[model samples]
Target: MALIDFSFYSSIYSYNHLFLTVLSFLVSALIFLASMRKSKLKRVNLPPGPAGWPIVGNLFQFARSGKPFFKYVEDLRPIYGPIFTLKMGTRTMVILSDAKLVHEALIERGSIFSTRPRENPTRNIFSCNKFTVNAAVYGPVWRSLRRNLVQNMLSSSRIKEFQHVRDKAMDTLINRLKAEAKANDGVVWVLKNARFAVFCILLAMCFGIDMDDETNEKMDQVMKLVLITLDPRIDDYLPILSPFFSKQRKRALEVRKEQIDFMVPFFEKRRKMLQNPESDKTAISFSYLDTLFDLKVEGRKSGPSNEELVSLCSEFINGGTDTTATGIEWGVAQLITNPHVQAKLYDEIKQTVGDRAVAEKDIDRMPYLRAVVKELLRKHPPTYFSLTHAVSEPTTLAGYDIPTDVNVEIYLQAIGEDPKLWRNPEKFNPERFISGGEDADITGVKGVKMMPFGVGRRICPGLGMGTVHIQLMLARMVQEFEWSAYPPNSKIDLTEKLEFTVVMKNSLKAMVKPRA
Candidate 1:
């Protein structure tokens, strides 16, 4: 019995050991092959860049660089040419720095590069799986959302409709500035006021609710939470670590809950108002919310759910306010730095509008003022890379083969500052835009040189609204007051820090006095 037991145990152990050894070897071989395959794929067809490490890819490069991530991409421009690729996590990221290449891909082949990557989980949760227009994949829902937003809120005619809203908001800003000028001895923080003004305008347009400073500040904090929660987190990129890093997810959940609590009431209030036909006086006015509520797609009976509605509203407010405010701040900063430009703008506004406050309609006659806004947007675009775009299928861009389902980033700053495109690109000169006999069109349809609001099918839906907002605000400020660096000899610090937008590192604090 003992002899039989020993033989049986030995045989069983030998077979089990053999199987375990084989399995381990197979796993090692498979991993090695996968790595080799990825390495091979990277070499062939892809545009040139530093060979990012295996698995983690270029993520380590991003972490170790200790610089704004976009600047890291910019540093590679000379070495890898304008168009290059970086493998980030399991995704392939293609960066287009050449204006011609960007024009070719985003403008010429718009549809192919219009989709978004599945890279950001935080965005997915925040968006509720493509509920918002910006986060949606290229499909029917995206089309409907974009079409609805553009037709109702952002079309040229629609922008004209909201001119009164812009003027009211500008008045608030002007009055606040005047008060600050008097109270602070002519030194005022420009960005805080700019943010408040822009937020108030957008909030009013979004919900038909005029925002006082307190309400505006409250919503501003919520929107900031939205931005923070929605931003790409480390756990999002390396999902394997998500279990250990639940803080971001928890925060996102909390923010989402807060969003629902904050936004659902607005929806319900409008819904109730619409339902009650007898109370015409109390009925909600036509606004972005009303449009969203009334939206009817061809095939759908039920419109966007409350969550989707909230996300859309949040996106609308966030997109319009931050980018527009950033542009206004940059315009003011530029004007302060180059007083001649400011004086020229002031003279143009004064000649056209006189002592009367600058109006939205007046901006049309003030070409130099328009040029100033364009030049400012060109020099300091709110977003360095317009929201990341992806290809739904394999496509060729600028004579390079692009893999399917890869992320693409168009470097707006690179195109804006190209030496070939503009003379002395770094210089603050609005004249370049007008001197060429045609204004440098911000809309990329005419040309793709510098698109601050992006270009092509995915161009920001808020372009018209934002352009008008900035131009109106800038013209009014220039018309009403003189802007200068707080200290006589100090220059406006142009140092930028990237956030939801690229903002001035130290916000513009300028001395102001009413124009005599």
Candidate 2:
């Protein structure tokens, strides 16, 4: 009886052990399969781009290519199509050249793609930690600053109030050009006088004070120094390499100090005027500084600091000056190069304004003048690329997975010249705009055929003001003088060199004779 009981217990124990072993193996296999599936799901499908060496990425290749960064990317378009990736140090940049893809990302997914990438340390120092409208992150601070600018200063009514300022500046510009032409044998440097004129207008609007030529020149020089400091540095892309760029960093800080010292007195002057009610009321016109003083940013307990004020003023002045001046220069160059276009434009101006100065209101009446400005901007955008944009969240652009931490840039020139979008894209034709292309929205709201001032929510708030400046100046220039290429029959060189804006490699030099 005992032997039979032992045999039964032993068989039961063996059966239980076998069942537990099989259950453990099944669980392990299932976990392994699940992990494999998860790994596959996490794999990102990034855009096609030239492969680079580990760590340093395409930095060496780009440096070795001996081409401007934009041109380098332009060359790659044939290889990788419109959208492609470039790895610069630890940073990943996605370049979009296709209008459809640009519209899709910057418009359809604007909320996700409108934010700015983290600025470099140097830029942050100047921007007061991204407090200015152009540099601020996409949030309450940006909304508050941008709203303040648009409503208070750039509004249509407000712009109309500044007409006298523009008129005075125009007079100064025409006088300066005529004097220079007289002194230099009917030859004048277009950009130099154009920039000074625009600067005068902006300086008055910014500080509510009209400075003499000497002071204006000094301020211009200081602003130029500030812009030089703002240029991109090697350390900006690779922070780990920052220690080597101590000299550059030191110079940037020094320039920042100089900027603050130069601008603070104007702030104090404005403050005093605001405080003393008995001060000359005529001398006190509403200025951007006035608005900044009263501004209440969303998250801040107090108004912008003096440092922040300097940065904001810099942004406002720098934003309008080089861009507007560059546009004027390019427009004049195009007029000189294509005399037929100039003649047509001049005839339109003559019919509209008729021997009088081109007023702001007259700009609205001339359609061909508008077309000429559009074509100039299309061919020579102020900047090669729009302000750097970033994704608010990880998203897919077209078929490619765009990570949240990458810089997104739209090649403005490439889109403007896209063969698929414009017929005979290489030719300088304003007539296209008068007909089918007249509907071409520079705002890129309806659809993006060309985006000179950028598009979507982050589009340049100064778009209206900027266009007005360009059109009015171009009209006045053409109506007041007969412009021809310098040195008699020499061709106006259209070769571009990138600066704060894409400026002509050889600044436009023209011979001017006053119109009858």
The C-alpha TM-scores of every prediction are 0.90, 0.90
- In angstroms, how far off is 430's CA in candidate 1? 0.7
What digit string (tens of lDDT, one per residue) describes model 2 on residues 1-516?
A: 000000000011112333323433443354545445544556678898998644446765676665677778889999999899988766888888899898898888889888888767887889889998888889999999999999998888998999999999899899998899899999999988888888888898888876778888889999999876776665565566578789988998999999999999989988888788457464547799999986899978899889999999988888899898988999999898899999999999999878778899988899999989888888877877887788888999878999988988888878888888889888889998887544578878778988888888788888888888888888888998999998899988889877777789988889998888
Candidate 1, residues 1-516: lDDT per residue as tens digits? 000000000011112334334433443445645767654545447787788655556666665655566677778889999888886656677888887787777788889888877755666777778777777888887889889988777778876777777777788898999998899899888888988888887787788654456767788888898875655544444454468557767777888899889878877766766677455463326688988876775467888788888888888888777777777788888888898999998889889988788877787899898788888878987777777788878877767788776678777788988988888889989998787643566667767788877778888777767777888888888888898887867877889876667788888889998878
Stretches > 4 Å off in candidate 1: 1-44, 276-284, 436-439
Name the best candidate (by lDDT): 2
RMSD (Å) of each candidate, 1 decimal: 12.4, 17.4
* Model 2 Cα shift for residue 223 (angstroms): 0.9
